[model samples]
Target: MSDDDLSEKVGYGHPPKKNRFPKGTSGNPKGRPKASKNVANAVELELDSKVTVIENGRKLKLSRGEVIAKTLVTKAMKGDLRAFDAVTKLLPKRFREPLAEANKSEPLDPYEAEVLERYISRRIAKEDSHD
Candidate 1:
Protein backbone atom coordinates (compact mmCIF):
# COMPACT_ATOMS: atom_id res chain seq x y z
CA MET A 1 0.00 0.00 0.00
CA SER A 2 1.12 3.61 -0.62
CA ASP A 3 2.20 5.85 2.35
CA ASP A 4 -1.08 7.94 1.97
CA ASP A 5 -3.25 4.79 2.20
CA LEU A 6 -1.25 3.54 5.25
CA SER A 7 -1.64 6.95 6.98
CA GLU A 8 -5.48 6.90 6.55
CA LYS A 9 -6.78 5.22 9.75
CA VAL A 10 -10.32 3.65 9.64
CA GLY A 11 -11.18 2.84 13.28
CA TYR A 12 -13.61 4.21 15.97
CA GLY A 13 -13.51 7.91 14.89
CA HIS A 14 -13.09 7.26 11.17
CA PRO A 15 -15.53 4.95 9.33
CA PRO A 16 -15.38 4.15 5.58
CA LYS A 17 -17.58 6.70 3.72
CA LYS A 18 -19.63 3.85 2.16
CA ASN A 19 -20.39 2.52 5.68
CA ARG A 20 -21.66 6.00 6.87
CA PHE A 21 -25.40 6.83 6.80
CA PRO A 22 -26.67 8.55 3.60
CA LYS A 23 -27.43 12.33 3.84
CA GLY A 24 -31.27 12.07 3.69
CA THR A 25 -31.81 8.85 5.68
CA SER A 26 -31.05 8.45 9.41
CA GLY A 27 -29.61 5.48 11.34
CA ASN A 28 -32.97 5.55 13.17
CA PRO A 29 -35.31 5.59 10.16
CA LYS A 30 -38.41 6.02 12.35
CA GLY A 31 -36.75 8.98 14.15
CA ARG A 32 -37.71 10.12 17.67
CA PRO A 33 -41.51 9.86 18.12
CA LYS A 34 -43.36 13.17 18.07
CA ALA A 35 -43.60 14.71 21.57
CA SER A 36 -46.98 14.52 23.33
CA LYS A 37 -49.13 17.63 23.82
CA ASN A 38 -47.34 19.90 26.34
CA VAL A 39 -48.89 21.16 29.61
CA ALA A 40 -49.95 24.61 28.28
CA ASN A 41 -51.60 23.02 25.22
CA ALA A 42 -53.41 20.55 27.50
CA VAL A 43 -54.61 23.40 29.74
CA GLU A 44 -55.83 25.43 26.73
CA LEU A 45 -57.71 22.39 25.39
CA GLU A 46 -59.31 21.86 28.81
CA LEU A 47 -60.36 25.51 29.07
CA ASP A 48 -61.97 25.39 25.62
CA SER A 49 -63.97 22.24 26.48
CA LYS A 50 -67.76 22.70 26.73
CA VAL A 51 -70.02 21.65 29.56
CA THR A 52 -73.75 21.97 30.27
CA VAL A 53 -74.94 23.97 33.25
CA ILE A 54 -78.43 24.82 34.60
CA GLU A 55 -79.22 28.51 34.70
CA ASN A 56 -82.67 30.02 35.38
CA GLY A 57 -84.00 26.45 35.31
CA ARG A 58 -82.78 26.18 31.69
CA LYS A 59 -79.91 24.14 30.33
CA LEU A 60 -76.99 26.20 29.08
CA LYS A 61 -73.83 25.22 27.27
CA LEU A 62 -70.74 27.14 28.34
CA SER A 63 -66.97 26.71 28.09
CA ARG A 64 -65.11 25.42 31.16
CA GLY A 65 -63.58 28.88 31.67
CA GLU A 66 -67.03 30.52 31.51
CA VAL A 67 -68.44 28.08 34.09
CA ILE A 68 -65.52 28.87 36.40
CA ALA A 69 -66.05 32.61 36.02
CA LYS A 70 -69.82 32.26 36.61
CA THR A 71 -69.13 30.20 39.74
CA LEU A 72 -66.63 32.78 40.97
CA VAL A 73 -69.15 35.64 40.46
CA THR A 74 -71.89 33.66 42.25
CA LYS A 75 -69.60 33.00 45.18
CA ALA A 76 -68.59 36.68 45.29
CA MET A 77 -72.29 37.73 45.29
CA LYS A 78 -72.80 35.44 48.31
CA GLY A 79 -70.26 37.51 50.28
CA ASP A 80 -67.18 35.37 49.62
CA LEU A 81 -64.51 38.05 50.08
CA ARG A 82 -61.72 35.96 48.52
CA ALA A 83 -63.89 35.24 45.49
CA PHE A 84 -64.71 38.94 45.17
CA ASP A 85 -60.99 39.76 45.26
CA ALA A 86 -60.30 37.09 42.63
CA VAL A 87 -63.11 38.38 40.38
CA THR A 88 -61.81 41.92 40.64
CA LYS A 89 -58.26 40.78 39.82
CA LEU A 90 -59.49 38.81 36.78
CA LEU A 91 -61.47 41.76 35.36
CA PRO A 92 -59.84 43.73 32.53
CA LYS A 93 -58.44 47.09 33.67
CA ARG A 94 -60.87 48.99 31.42
CA PHE A 95 -63.85 47.22 33.04
CA ARG A 96 -62.60 47.36 36.62
CA GLU A 97 -63.86 50.07 38.97
CA PRO A 98 -61.10 52.18 40.50
CA LEU A 99 -60.91 51.74 44.29
CA ALA A 100 -60.51 55.48 44.95
CA GLU A 101 -63.49 56.34 42.75
CA ALA A 102 -65.61 53.60 44.35
CA ASN A 103 -64.68 54.74 47.83
CA LYS A 104 -65.41 58.36 46.96
CA SER A 105 -68.89 57.46 45.62
CA GLU A 106 -69.87 55.17 48.54
CA PRO A 107 -69.01 56.71 51.88
CA LEU A 108 -68.04 54.26 54.63
CA ASP A 109 -70.41 53.74 57.58
CA PRO A 110 -69.56 55.71 60.76
CA TYR A 111 -68.13 52.61 62.48
CA GLU A 112 -66.05 51.66 59.44
CA ALA A 113 -64.78 55.23 59.05
CA GLU A 114 -63.87 55.39 62.75
CA VAL A 115 -62.05 52.05 62.54
CA LEU A 116 -60.09 53.21 59.48
CA GLU A 117 -59.19 56.47 61.21
CA ARG A 118 -57.95 54.59 64.29
CA TYR A 119 -55.94 52.17 62.12
CA ILE A 120 -54.28 55.04 60.29
CA SER A 121 -53.49 56.84 63.59
CA ARG A 122 -51.99 53.67 65.06
CA ARG A 123 -49.85 53.14 61.95
CA ILE A 124 -48.59 56.72 62.16
CA ALA A 125 -47.91 56.35 65.86
CA LYS A 126 -46.00 53.13 65.27
CA GLU A 127 -43.86 54.82 62.60
CA ASP A 128 -43.17 57.77 64.96
CA SER A 129 -42.19 55.36 67.72
CA HIS A 130 -39.82 53.52 65.32
CA ASP A 131 -38.16 56.82 64.39
Candidate 2:
Protein backbone atom coordinates (compact mmCIF):
# COMPACT_ATOMS: atom_id res chain seq x y z
CA MET A 1 0.00 0.00 0.00
CA SER A 2 1.07 3.61 -0.63
CA ASP A 3 2.32 5.71 2.32
CA ASP A 4 -0.78 7.89 1.93
CA ASP A 5 -3.02 4.79 2.07
CA LEU A 6 -1.23 3.47 5.21
CA SER A 7 -1.46 6.87 6.93
CA GLU A 8 -5.17 7.06 6.14
CA LYS A 9 -5.93 3.66 7.75
CA VAL A 10 -5.74 4.86 11.42
CA GLY A 11 -7.73 3.09 14.12
CA TYR A 12 -5.95 1.33 17.03
CA GLY A 13 -2.15 1.63 16.42
CA HIS A 14 -2.24 4.90 14.53
CA PRO A 15 -3.57 8.42 15.11
CA PRO A 16 -4.84 10.85 12.52
CA LYS A 17 -2.35 13.44 11.19
CA LYS A 18 -4.11 16.31 12.97
CA ASN A 19 -3.62 14.51 16.33
CA ARG A 20 0.00 13.42 15.65
CA PHE A 21 3.05 15.19 17.18
CA PRO A 22 4.38 18.07 15.06
CA LYS A 23 7.62 17.51 13.08
CA GLY A 24 9.89 19.92 15.04
CA THR A 25 8.30 19.46 18.48
CA SER A 26 9.17 16.85 21.10
CA GLY A 27 6.63 14.82 23.11
CA ASN A 28 8.35 16.01 26.31
CA PRO A 29 9.48 19.56 25.64
CA LYS A 30 11.44 20.13 28.89
CA GLY A 31 12.78 16.55 29.03
CA ARG A 32 14.39 15.11 32.21
CA PRO A 33 15.70 17.72 34.71
CA LYS A 34 19.46 18.31 34.49
CA ALA A 35 19.78 18.13 38.30
CA SER A 36 18.20 14.66 38.67
CA LYS A 37 20.45 11.72 39.46
CA ASN A 38 19.38 8.06 39.10
CA VAL A 39 19.30 5.79 42.19
CA ALA A 40 22.64 4.05 41.52
CA ASN A 41 24.44 7.32 40.85
CA ALA A 42 22.98 8.95 43.97
CA VAL A 43 23.91 5.96 46.13
CA GLU A 44 27.47 5.92 44.76
CA LEU A 45 27.94 9.60 45.51
CA GLU A 46 26.64 9.15 49.07
CA LEU A 47 28.82 6.10 49.72
CA ASP A 48 31.96 7.86 48.48
CA SER A 49 31.53 10.79 50.86
CA LYS A 50 33.97 10.92 53.80
CA VAL A 51 32.86 10.64 57.42
CA THR A 52 34.44 10.37 60.88
CA VAL A 53 34.67 6.88 62.36
CA ILE A 54 35.94 5.64 65.73
CA GLU A 55 38.30 2.64 65.57
CA ASN A 56 40.65 1.22 68.21
CA GLY A 57 39.74 4.15 70.51
CA ARG A 58 40.84 6.67 67.88
CA LYS A 59 38.70 8.85 65.65
CA LEU A 60 39.62 8.42 62.01
CA LYS A 61 38.30 9.84 58.74
CA LEU A 62 37.02 7.26 56.28
CA SER A 63 34.64 7.00 53.39
CA ARG A 64 31.02 6.28 54.34
CA GLY A 65 31.23 2.99 52.44
CA GLU A 66 34.35 1.96 54.41
CA VAL A 67 32.64 2.81 57.71
CA ILE A 68 29.62 0.69 56.77
CA ALA A 69 31.82 -2.25 55.74
CA LYS A 70 33.77 -2.06 59.04
CA THR A 71 30.52 -1.98 61.00
CA LEU A 72 29.25 -5.09 59.15
CA VAL A 73 32.50 -7.00 59.85
CA THR A 74 32.49 -5.95 63.53
CA LYS A 75 28.89 -7.14 63.92
CA ALA A 76 29.81 -10.46 62.27
CA MET A 77 32.78 -10.93 64.63
CA LYS A 78 30.46 -10.40 67.64
CA GLY A 79 28.49 -13.60 66.75
CA ASP A 80 25.68 -11.94 64.83
CA LEU A 81 24.74 -14.77 62.42
CA ARG A 82 22.89 -12.58 59.93
CA ALA A 83 25.74 -10.04 59.89
CA PHE A 84 28.25 -12.86 59.38
CA ASP A 85 26.33 -14.12 56.34
CA ALA A 86 26.02 -10.57 54.96
CA VAL A 87 29.77 -9.92 55.38
CA THR A 88 30.63 -13.26 53.78
CA LYS A 89 28.46 -12.46 50.77
CA LEU A 90 29.86 -8.92 50.48
CA LEU A 91 33.54 -9.98 50.45
CA PRO A 92 35.34 -11.18 47.32
CA LYS A 93 35.38 -14.97 46.90
CA ARG A 94 39.13 -15.16 47.55
CA PHE A 95 38.84 -13.10 50.75
CA ARG A 96 35.77 -15.04 51.90
CA GLU A 97 37.53 -18.41 51.55
CA PRO A 98 40.55 -17.25 53.61
CA LEU A 99 38.29 -15.71 56.28
CA ALA A 100 36.28 -18.94 56.49
CA GLU A 101 39.47 -20.98 56.88
CA ALA A 102 40.79 -18.66 59.61
CA ASN A 103 37.47 -18.85 61.47
CA LYS A 104 37.58 -22.64 61.43
CA SER A 105 41.16 -22.79 62.77
CA GLU A 106 40.78 -20.08 65.38
CA PRO A 107 39.58 -20.95 68.86
CA LEU A 108 36.45 -19.29 70.15
CA ASP A 109 36.67 -16.77 73.01
CA PRO A 110 36.19 -18.24 76.51
CA TYR A 111 32.67 -16.86 76.88
CA GLU A 112 31.65 -18.12 73.44
CA ALA A 113 33.07 -21.54 74.20
CA GLU A 114 31.18 -21.65 77.49
CA VAL A 115 27.97 -20.62 75.76
CA LEU A 116 28.41 -23.33 73.13
CA GLU A 117 29.02 -25.98 75.82
CA ARG A 118 25.87 -24.99 77.72
CA TYR A 119 23.83 -24.97 74.50
CA ILE A 120 25.09 -28.42 73.51
CA SER A 121 24.39 -29.89 76.96
CA ARG A 122 20.88 -28.46 76.98
CA ARG A 123 20.19 -29.76 73.45
CA ILE A 124 21.41 -33.22 74.38
CA ALA A 125 19.25 -33.26 77.51
CA LYS A 126 16.20 -32.16 75.52
CA GLU A 127 16.75 -34.89 72.91
CA ASP A 128 17.27 -37.54 75.63
CA SER A 129 14.00 -36.55 77.32
CA HIS A 130 12.19 -36.67 73.94
CA ASP A 131 13.52 -40.16 73.29
Candidate 3:
Protein backbone atom coordinates (compact mmCIF):
# COMPACT_ATOMS: atom_id res chain seq x y z
CA MET A 1 0.00 0.00 0.00
CA SER A 2 0.98 3.58 -0.50
CA ASP A 3 1.80 5.91 2.39
CA ASP A 4 -1.68 7.31 2.31
CA ASP A 5 -3.24 3.82 2.41
CA LEU A 6 -0.96 2.82 5.26
CA SER A 7 -1.92 5.95 7.15
CA GLU A 8 -5.59 5.08 6.63
CA LYS A 9 -5.10 1.50 7.80
CA VAL A 10 -3.27 2.64 10.94
CA GLY A 11 -6.44 4.57 11.96
CA TYR A 12 -4.32 7.25 13.63
CA GLY A 13 -6.17 9.77 11.43
CA HIS A 14 -2.87 11.39 10.47
CA PRO A 15 0.53 9.92 9.47
CA PRO A 16 3.67 10.38 11.52
CA LYS A 17 5.90 13.25 10.62
CA LYS A 18 8.77 12.42 8.31
CA ASN A 19 12.31 13.07 9.39
CA ARG A 20 15.23 14.34 7.35
CA PHE A 21 18.57 15.98 7.75
CA PRO A 22 18.86 19.73 7.77
CA LYS A 23 19.89 21.47 4.57
CA GLY A 24 23.59 21.41 3.79
CA THR A 25 24.23 19.17 6.77
CA SER A 26 26.14 15.91 6.60
CA GLY A 27 25.06 12.86 8.52
CA ASN A 28 28.58 11.76 9.23
CA PRO A 29 30.03 14.00 11.95
CA LYS A 30 33.60 12.81 11.67
CA GLY A 31 33.63 13.19 7.87
CA ARG A 32 35.82 10.96 5.76
CA PRO A 33 39.46 10.38 6.68
CA LYS A 34 42.07 11.83 4.34
CA ALA A 35 45.05 10.46 2.47
CA SER A 36 48.70 11.17 3.27
CA LYS A 37 49.39 14.87 3.64
CA ASN A 38 53.15 15.16 3.64
CA VAL A 39 55.76 12.56 2.79
CA ALA A 40 57.30 12.63 6.25
CA ASN A 41 54.26 11.70 8.27
CA ALA A 42 54.30 8.23 9.79
CA VAL A 43 51.53 5.64 9.65
CA GLU A 44 50.74 2.31 11.28
CA LEU A 45 50.67 -1.12 9.68
CA GLU A 46 48.96 -4.09 11.21
CA LEU A 47 51.86 -6.51 10.73
CA ASP A 48 54.61 -4.76 8.85
CA SER A 49 56.02 -1.25 8.69
CA LYS A 50 53.66 1.33 7.22
CA VAL A 51 56.32 3.11 5.19
CA THR A 52 56.47 2.12 1.54
CA VAL A 53 59.01 3.18 -1.03
CA ILE A 54 57.86 3.65 -4.60
CA GLU A 55 59.82 3.62 -7.87
CA ASN A 56 63.45 4.60 -7.99
CA GLY A 57 64.61 5.98 -4.64
CA ARG A 58 61.35 7.71 -3.85
CA LYS A 59 59.74 6.99 -0.53
CA LEU A 60 56.19 7.68 0.61
CA LYS A 61 55.54 7.72 4.33
CA LEU A 62 51.92 7.23 5.24
CA SER A 63 50.06 9.37 7.77
CA ARG A 64 47.47 8.62 10.39
CA GLY A 65 46.79 12.35 10.54
CA GLU A 66 44.44 14.13 8.15
CA VAL A 67 45.56 15.04 4.63
CA ILE A 68 44.43 17.27 1.83
CA ALA A 69 44.89 15.06 -1.21
CA LYS A 70 42.67 13.42 -3.72
CA THR A 71 43.48 10.21 -5.56
CA LEU A 72 46.80 10.07 -7.37
CA VAL A 73 45.19 8.77 -10.56
CA THR A 74 42.96 11.82 -10.91
CA LYS A 75 45.85 14.11 -10.09
CA ALA A 76 47.94 12.46 -12.79
CA MET A 77 45.19 12.68 -15.36
CA LYS A 78 44.29 16.26 -14.56
CA GLY A 79 47.93 17.29 -14.37
CA ASP A 80 47.05 19.18 -11.26
CA LEU A 81 49.50 20.65 -8.79
CA ARG A 82 49.72 17.30 -7.07
CA ALA A 83 50.72 15.68 -10.36
CA PHE A 84 53.70 18.00 -10.66
CA ASP A 85 54.31 17.82 -6.94
CA ALA A 86 54.38 14.03 -7.09
CA VAL A 87 57.73 13.96 -8.89
CA THR A 88 59.24 13.76 -5.43
CA LYS A 89 58.16 10.16 -5.66
CA LEU A 90 61.02 9.58 -8.14
CA LEU A 91 63.87 11.03 -6.10
CA PRO A 92 65.01 10.55 -2.52
CA LYS A 93 63.94 13.04 0.19
CA ARG A 94 67.36 14.70 0.45
CA PHE A 95 67.45 15.20 -3.29
CA ARG A 96 64.03 16.86 -3.31
CA GLU A 97 65.05 19.76 -1.05
CA PRO A 98 68.28 20.43 -2.89
CA LEU A 99 66.62 20.16 -6.26
CA ALA A 100 63.90 22.56 -5.30
CA GLU A 101 66.51 24.89 -3.81
CA ALA A 102 68.92 24.68 -6.73
CA ASN A 103 69.48 27.72 -8.89
CA LYS A 104 69.54 25.81 -12.19
CA SER A 105 67.99 22.52 -11.14
CA GLU A 106 65.46 21.60 -13.74
CA PRO A 107 61.96 20.57 -12.74
CA LEU A 108 60.88 17.04 -13.39
CA ASP A 109 61.22 16.98 -17.14
CA PRO A 110 58.25 14.86 -18.13
CA TYR A 111 60.15 13.75 -21.22
CA GLU A 112 63.24 12.90 -19.20
CA ALA A 113 61.28 11.01 -16.58
CA GLU A 114 60.55 8.50 -19.31
CA VAL A 115 59.85 5.38 -17.31
CA LEU A 116 57.43 6.98 -14.91
CA GLU A 117 55.78 9.19 -17.52
CA ARG A 118 55.24 6.23 -19.81
CA TYR A 119 53.85 4.16 -17.00
CA ILE A 120 51.39 6.87 -16.09
CA SER A 121 50.44 7.39 -19.71
CA ARG A 122 49.78 3.72 -20.26
CA ARG A 123 47.64 3.49 -17.17
CA ILE A 124 45.63 6.55 -18.13
CA ALA A 125 45.21 5.28 -21.66
CA LYS A 126 44.01 1.94 -20.41
CA GLU A 127 41.54 3.62 -18.08
CA ASP A 128 40.21 5.68 -20.97
CA SER A 129 40.04 2.72 -23.35
CA HIS A 130 36.88 1.39 -21.73
CA ASP A 131 35.07 4.61 -22.34
lDDT of each: 0.88, 0.88, 0.58
List where candidate 3 sits over 4 angstroms from the true fold.
Answer: 1-43, 46-78, 86-91, 101-131
Q: Write the per-residue lDDT of candidate 3 for residues 9-71, one digit (tens) a residue.
A: 333554343544567978797888898666344332332344453535766664322122334
Q: TM-score order of candidates, best first?
A: 1, 2, 3
Worst 10 residues of 3 by lDDT: 62-71
Instruction: Identify the candidate with maximal TM-score.
Output: 1
Query: Once superposed on the true structure, which residue ranges of model 2 sit more than 4 Å away at CA?
Result: 1-36, 97-131
TM-score per model over all chains: 0.52, 0.47, 0.19
* Clash statistics: count for each candidate: 0, 0, 0
Error of 1 at 101 (Å): 2.4
lDDT per residue as tens, model 2, 1-131: 67886759688877887799999999899997787678999999999999987888999999999988988999999987789999889879989888878778767899999999999899889879999
TM-score of 2: 0.47
